[model samples]
Target: MTRLGYQVPNFTYPGVGSDGLFEAVAAQAVEAEESGFDTVLVMDHFYQLPMLGAPDNAMIECYTLLAALSQRTSRVRLSALVTGNTYRHPSLLAKTVTALDVVSGGRAQLGIGAGWFELEHDSLGFEFGTFTERFEKLEEALRIVIPMLRGERPSLEGTWYSVHEAINSPAPVGRIPVMIGGGGEKKTLRMVAQYADESNIICAPDEIPRKLAALDEHCERLGRDRSEITVTYQTSAVIAPTKEQAQAELDAAVAAIPELAARAGGVILGSPDEVRPIYERILASGVDGVTVNLPANGHVPGRVALLGETLAPVVNRS
Candidate 1:
């Protein structure tokens, strides 16, 4: 349901350290709300992701940061970009998001995915199962989570998780939209067609049409309305006042996080004028929403605001 979202996936920045990091994050959230971003998200990871920095870089727990963010700003929806399923029990995750909804006055969404960070699991003492096993666990977890979100106390005897009439008491004030992030055609898209209210995918700009078409086919096979699920692209962007400046910013970004340059998919770089057409093309492909990775420049004072001011209208128009 969110048309435009901003993600703060990193905490370490040029001048801000751990002592003032959360305050800086809170400031970005407030700025995002003021600048027309509909939702604010933090990455649900234990370590700083490889592209961003070393594992030991300052990474706060996701839900804790979201709870703190709820107090600092009003109106913007809050969520993790996608919570890794292996880290917590399904019932606990359901309760946590519900609590977030209650605290934020019903502005909460649950974005979840099959756990991917093996290193995080290994270090945190969670089971690092085979890919098939992880997806199996995610399937079972959703059965428990979706029912609880809808106010039903589901009893499930699943292979990975079992709950006997798990009650989510003091239920959330409203429905918390469930967003599943991933683009696996056979497994993930099938699950999205069956259970998710939204799907977030990362792909090359030109690959969007094919992905959306595949999702449509999945919906048709499941007898689900394609319109029922909002399709959002997860991307990274570079923006600046002028074309040359934007390119410079992007070069600096790619230089710092070489992964951005290596993996060109889902990374858009340019000034508003240049970036607008790419958004237009993607929106024309029928993407209903977007959530961007802005960690590289998001901590800078006006960077988030500038992004919102420049790109929000472009997205909204398309």
Candidate 2:
């Protein structure tokens, strides 16, 4: 379980061009590892998310970045916040994550979800199906992916995917925990109960209780123990050494990306003393852990470190 995780959702840092982009990313990962964060994640998308920036903004491939970060930092577990299932075949994904686990010396996890970014799909020539169709594909993909990750040769014939005695050699160095990301009551949470080792609920803090109840219901229907799966919450944060500085950062972020203003309530914004209780309240809502993406000033040196310092004690306390 990831008690505290840092996500790198933006790559367009000020003053750093393409030549120093990877190094900037690497520096944050190293800092997070040293600062008490147990996990580090990156978004899995070919193009920048519209809520964050223009389509032409710098965006690196997810797994390649993780594989590279694995060499740069050794302690923090690495994964995509969630890999879009429609982007790759199930067996191949299992193979890729298994290789990541090997290279990372058993510090790799597989975080995945049903594909959602239609613009990326349409631009990249990948099939962008209906919501129902995408969920169907995700279900079929999991059936094949789960067994393969456990070192079994799975044979499956389904509507969206098919595999016959699929082989995944050089099995993962250790168990590669499957983390499913989403909070939909019907399809997403049900799939999380049935297949995933971890469930990342993407909702506002006030909504976590309802989402957890939905997940509990699914676990009950499936006759699976609720404790079998770990639950985590996903949200954005903007923290500074002082309240005024934090507000300035938030204001700047909302100015640059107007969409963020609409979702400001879901974001944690303040200094360490101010935000610690916010996180405590979130953890009190019953999530086993939390993963935060620092979209406002994460690329700035020591920003991620400060976030980890503030959050690690709050989340990891016994």
Candidate 3:
């Protein structure tokens, strides 16, 4: 199945307390599941970025949101966009997710990647180190996280982390998919091939074919079937009624995110009809899924509902 999922970055809002944020997001999450979205992701960030809002804006902790989302949505898989390796020990993360999985009735997956947001690290008083070092810690964290989740005895004495007798009380019944997020070639893909059940990439529609080829090569090196590791890419989609309107919305969003505008990769800016061809193009790229990051203006729920109500049929047909 060419599954379609929605990613909610939980950008921000003009809210003061958790009541408004929780009610709003939970409503959307339930709507997403009923709308037929395969999964729902909440961003893992300590603080809202400058682009989104001030540092102390309406933001919920990742795990707390996941716990609430677990109770609220029945079918939609819930996860962090990618949790920081530095935030918690692998064993603690394992136990947390085990309880989440149990509470959510096995509707949880772990989306983990090397942490990159410097402001989040600095603001939270987390040690912000060099990229290489962070990636190194990510590699070590994966070693610990995977084993603990699999009910294996985990003992790792790496440069960044050391854990002995790492364990979980209740192991997840099914292998909870470990999703690695990044578009890097050398280190990220190699590690995904070695350990991950899924891999996420960010690139233009034109670049996907090549990154996929690299991932396939990495799979071959690891002697794993490319099909076994689900292939999914992250894309920003601006949906409008007409081509002209969609382009206008795209311009508005690009103006909002100049850095993203400068990058030509994975922006699906068009009406549903125009974007239909793009989804077909990605479907032909040998991926199992496509995660559509919709516009988070007031109509996010409506937009996602429209996708599930409208575009999802097309996605399934492909």
Candidate 4:
């Protein structure tokens, strides 16, 4: 269930240009693995989202980057932070992630969600459906993806999709865990109860207990045990050797993205001594683990290492 995962959502590094983009990403992936991160995720987007930067900012295709990452690292699980279900065909995505599992020695996880970035869809000429339509597509997509992942050829005809005994060959070496990412109370959690192996909730720390309780309700209504699903949280974080430096990093982040000021409480800050208690509280709240983006200083070689060596043990223990 991803004990301590690291996500590399920002591709725009300080010194690395386009030519060295992958090298920079690989460097971080390797460092994350060395730092005790069990899973490493890259966002699935054709262009950088507004939260990160402009549309023209460096962004790589998700499956391609993951395939490349599979070659660069041996142990860490590779996947998209959450694949946009609208961008590619469900059958094709099944094959892609299966290939990733094959090449990465079965250390691949499929993290997917209802596609949400309108800009990418409009610019890339993909259908930008309404929210309800996207969720419908996601539910349909899971019907196809789950069976294919289990080495089945499903012939399905639904309101949103159609497949005729579509096959996935050279299937995953072992069962590839499917993670449905979102915090939608009604639809998303219900889908997780019915289908997903894991669920990633993205919300403020204060909101986690409520989210978990809602998920539990969804599971009970579906006659499923909540324990069947591994629950993880996704958020940005700031960690340093000292509290002052961590605060400075947090301040810089908030200054860069003014909206972050309000969400600062959710961002893990300060030294390991300080951060561990925050993590402990999160764990106590029933969160199985966390996936963090260290965009502020991930490019700095040793920052990830310090996070791993200092904070990982605490999370692991929890």
By lDDT, the best candidate is: 2
Report the C-alpha lDDT of model 3 over 1-318, residue by residue, as the tens digit. Answer: 116777775445434255577777776677677777888887788786554445765567888889888888888888877787778777788887777788889888898888887888877788879999988988988888888888897898888888988867788856688888887888888888888988888776678888788888999988988877877878767676676766665566556554335432445766677877778778787777788766433234466665666557666676
What C-alpha lDDT do the candidate models reach, one value each?
Answer: 0.85, 0.90, 0.74, 0.86
Please give each candidate's TM-score. 0.94, 0.96, 0.88, 0.94
What TM-score does prediction 3 earn? 0.88
Candidate 4 ranges with C-alpha deviation above 4 Å = 247-266
lDDT of 2 by residue, 1-318 (tens): 677889998888767899999999999999899999999999999998887877877899999999999999989999999999989999999999998999999999999999899999999998989999999999999999889989899999899889999999999999889899999989999999999989998876789999999999999999989998999999788889988988888788777766567656667889999989989999999999999988878887888899999989988882
- Tens-place lDDT digits, model 4, residues 1-318: 676889997787656798999988898899889989999999999998776666887898888898999898988988888999998899999999999999899998999999999988998899989999999999999999999999899999999889999999998998899999999989998899999889999887789988888889988988998887999888677888998988887677656655446656656777888877777787778888888887666776777777777658877887
lDDT of 2: 0.90
In Å, residue 74's CA in model 4 sits off its true spot by: 1.4
Q: Which segments of model 2 are wrong by more than 4 Å?
A: 253-265
Q: All predictions: root-mean-square deviation over Cα?
A: 1.8, 1.4, 3.0, 2.0
Candidate 3 versus truth, CA RMSD in Å, comes to: 3.0
TM-score, candidate 2, is 0.96
TM-score of candidate 4 on Cα atoms, chains taken together: 0.94
The deviation in Å at residue 1 for candidate 3 is 10
Best by TM-score: 2
Q: Write model 1 residue lDDT over 1-318, tens digit each, in one string.
A: 778999997787766678898999998899899998999999999998877767887888999999999999999999998999999999999999999999899999999999898898899899979999999999999999989989999999889999999999889989999899998888988899999999999877778888888888999999999889999998777666676776666666667666546543445777777776776777777898788766456776777888888768877787
Worst 10 residues of 2 by lDDT: 257-266
Q: Give the TM-score of candidate 1.
A: 0.94
Rank the candidate models, highest lDDT first.
2, 4, 1, 3
Ranking by TM-score: 2, 1, 4, 3
